[model samples]
Target: MAILILLTTQLRAWSQGEPPYITLLQGDSIYVGNSIALQDTVFYDVLLKPTIEKTLSVYNIISLRINEFDTKVIPDSFQVHVKVRIYYADSANAQDSIDEKTLTVTYNKFSTYEGKAILRLRGAHWVQVKVLEVTADYATLSAVLPVVELENRMVINRDFYMDEEDDAITTISKDTTTLEDCQELKVYWTPSQVAEMYDLEWTFIDSSAINAGWYNTGGVKDPVKIFRNNASRVRISSDQYLIPLLYDGKGALYYRVRAVQEKENGEILYTVWSDLGDHRFTGHETNLNWQATTTFAEEGKRKSVVQYFDGSLRGRQTVTRDNTTKTTLVAETLYDKQGRPVIQVLPAPTLSQLIAYTPLFNVEDETKEYHKGVYDTLSGSSQYCSQTSVPFSPASGAANYYSASNPAAEEKEFQYIPESNGYAFVQT
Candidate 1:
């Protein structure tokens, strides 16, 4: 079977096997305020209960409850506009505010979801379902049906084609055992005719050296660690993968193929981050054990850090059919660590919000990135030891955005200025 490995630092509940009370699915949360009490809308699921009337299609009665939340401190009146709608069988009822009151210090979204309806507060983390009554056979609930979260995981086939001319290409299987070296793999993929829709890259590797190759990836005398025109491709497609690179070069290579636009910054794209350098040409063709890994970072860097550290890398992809646009490629990521993600430190970290919003003038790239480096005099001057955001490009209008140099955070705010029909920033 073909596999795509992804790594991230986000916390998600995956079969945690928590009690029904603590086990919250999509659309769920506890409403707590640090101010006065307020009311918020909620949603629930399908339930079978004795309605005041007879059989009314798929419907249930929603109730209103008022209470204070855990937080909602002084001045900040903790209140939410409560609305309830029922979703049964297929459709949902019109949105209606059942109650509007102060924050009720309690974890409510849980029961709501358990009961069936999902809840989503304006600008909140998740949506939850509202629980009304649950019987062995039937369940009744009162909540506004909500949009489900996007499931963007995919199984990819990374193959190589002879050239863009031929349509028939052989898929490089991952189960061969011939231990050897295969060089100069040729592959082709059309961005126009897409299969399942995803991003595509031609090169991949397991990991990189602790602190090496920030400029060019593969080249002699090119100390900049910059990549060649075609290092590799991070891609996705509905058709199978076609590869011709495994015929001569090393057959054993680590390749990470995932869906395009399916990952967030700081999310792990693949696994294998120990002490190995990025292996661009480790192709083992005959054995079927073809594995390749890639390393990403700046020069004078210790390791490749996460692109953007969102605590959790997995995120929602734009909802579209499986055949839509082939795929909308987003930033791809790969992790070489173990366990779930909660925002681990990248090999080379980046800037935080402090410097992101900072103002700058003149620049080529709209965003500026900072890294760990020496500054000031050898004496006890203002030289940062670990991480700091300083002037990267000193040219006039050269620095537009700010970066802390932390790779995981992908940390840098854009200077969005309305241009003609699009927005332009000094840095992006």
Candidate 2:
């Protein structure tokens, strides 16, 4: 890799009064393809590890510029051509002409002239600038060309295990399995040339929505990092029950890997983070217990009621009519004692008595009957009622049924279904 230094120092003679030559100005040495450094030189030549055997190394000339020089007599025009020849390290007779390109430079006396070169391919070879021709008088040329070396890229692979058996990896196209069965995870990557260390990090996501605030906001912890001692693989185990049980039911775990290369001179280079690998963990067997309250306007009064239930049973009900409120608990008929269900009974108020004092008790008075017996006093005739004679009822029966106060708390029993990984209401 050639270092580009911006011309800050005054122009100095390359040789005593031999027309000060121009060289590389300011620029950093760039790694070719990989993140490792195998050799160190002022301008090091990079050796690319080809994916296939018997392949040639490819080179690209990113940017070229003329550095320091005396601008007394500006050259009208100058031509630059790169000559690259490849030869086997074992035999000099095995030589081949790989690349040759002639570039025209727009010369400026006071400022630098930027030029671009076409890509070239050569197998373990040497590169040199051959001045094809110079067009102006007293137009001497001095050039500085940097050689860039590309590094070998790395790839990561992952596998999962449960106990001593290897678990089949789950993918988007594959069916999801329970996480309770998995106890270990392994992540590995192909070793990169010039890489001295590797860094791994991972995090867990509880839902599909990405919480940017969870990662960006203060007080949030960073992802867990695991360093490897130049090893190509790492294993993580939750055998001791280190993995926390997810109360939210299910979640996904994501991980990233990167290679780190440090030069002997204390210079550090890092590869970008690899693509994210995600694993979904299911089989959250915890019971859910919650209560919901609903409120509605009735007879110029706001009425509210609450219903509570657990995973296996409906537990209680509470009702509020205006300022008065009442609660009824549905006693469990059976209790689990050491896996044995024992029968028990506790006396509690019935549903009718609980709402008797509330506005719900007057629901029947507010309801209207649509059908009526027709008897005209003026005509003194008995007949079926017409639409006009029929009592008008605003579909009040359905609404009144829900509004009626009940003290006997209803109970619903749910059975867990392993195939669906959920519960179903079996009896109410």
Candidate 3:
């Protein structure tokens, strides 16, 4: 992709022997469907990938500025048109030649600042760039150049096994069983806890290749935006493409899905796939278990689901109450010949269940000491940002302790959960 260095570096160049001047301005979000308002305007393009495709290649964006003193027209308001020629340059060098992504930019213009995502640099040097777009906000006086190839990408695909127990009885049979209709999707990846630019891609494929296009977890449908700054709409394919998400032995990937099967005649059917009311308790109060039942309100453009710890616990209350907090967990002491606290890790919640489900743990108030052991630093490292109300420690508390649920910068309080191998918790 032909990315613009919208963020300019201080470079002095004399063109007509006058005082040298240069300015750079980057572009903002470029959305889909005919138009997505942008912070800048420039050449743009996109790569369309089919569902279930494991690998994804890049695209390009290119633009030519028209000077006012010379061309005498505002680029943003004028007839702005771009012609792109794509090429695959293995070398970051400007001298190499390669395959093309898009030969011509088709039906492109900006309604706002920057309206495009990828551009192609043709003729001189076809360099594949993966970042930063040029918008009308940029100084047209400054000369524009092709972006250089910066890095490589290993497209990681995330897969999760799901079963809708609530719909089990509605199924015709075992193989012809009914499952929760999917709505929103949450991808949780651990990027090896390293610092790297991860391009996330999200595609929910049903029986074969049909993508699940419906309301996100937050419930907003129209103007559904996918951009860099949006945590929910990760620029990459899936949120959980990193190490921990693949086969971490923890709560595997879980996507909040909502499905709506519409009839040609106009009747709307709400499948188990709907996420219109998925929520958790947000108040300070807790359920019978220490776990909070009321969840926080949806924040930002995206709503995500993360598996904080290995066990996505589910403690079914044989009873119910508004104030389930301060209740104690009852368990008969059962142990092997050796005397020890008996415990084993519980299975995680399913995608269908998690959308409307709250994590249920059996930890008593006394066992609350585990929160202290949680070490905010360690717990923060692996959280799903969009799924979590937590936040990373700007203090650089190191990896394993990153918390996406920091209350200081967030609207909700997320309980820190740490993972263990054999059991969800161990007794002293």
Provide C-alpha RMSD values for all models, in order.
22.1, 26.8, 22.7
Whole-model lDDT, model 3: 0.24
**What is the Å distance of residue 391 in model 3 from its true position?**
41
> Which parts of model 1 are misplaced by more than 4 Å?
1-121, 125-132, 135-226, 235-247, 251-276, 280-428
| C-alpha lDDT of all candidate models, in order | 0.24, 0.30, 0.24
Query: Top TM-score: which candidate number?
Result: 2
- Best-to-worst order by lDDT is 2, 3, 1
Stretch of 10 with least lDDT, candidate 3: 168-177
Among all candidates shown, the one with the greatest lDDT: 2
Using all chains and alpha carbons, the TM-scores for the candidates as numbered come to 0.19, 0.21, 0.18
lDDT of 2 by residue, 59-109 (tens): 222123333343333344443332222111111223233233333334454
- Where does candidate 3 stray beyond 4 Å? 1-76, 79-87, 90-114, 117-428
Alpha-carbon error at 183 in model 3, in Å? 27
Per-residue CA lDDT of candidate 3, range 163-198, in tens?
Answer: 233321121101111113222223333221111122
What ordering of candidates by TM-score runs from best to worst?
Answer: 2, 1, 3
Distance from true location, Cα of 12 in model 2, Å: 51
Among all windows of ten consecutive residues in candidate 2, which has the lowest summed lDDT?
419-428
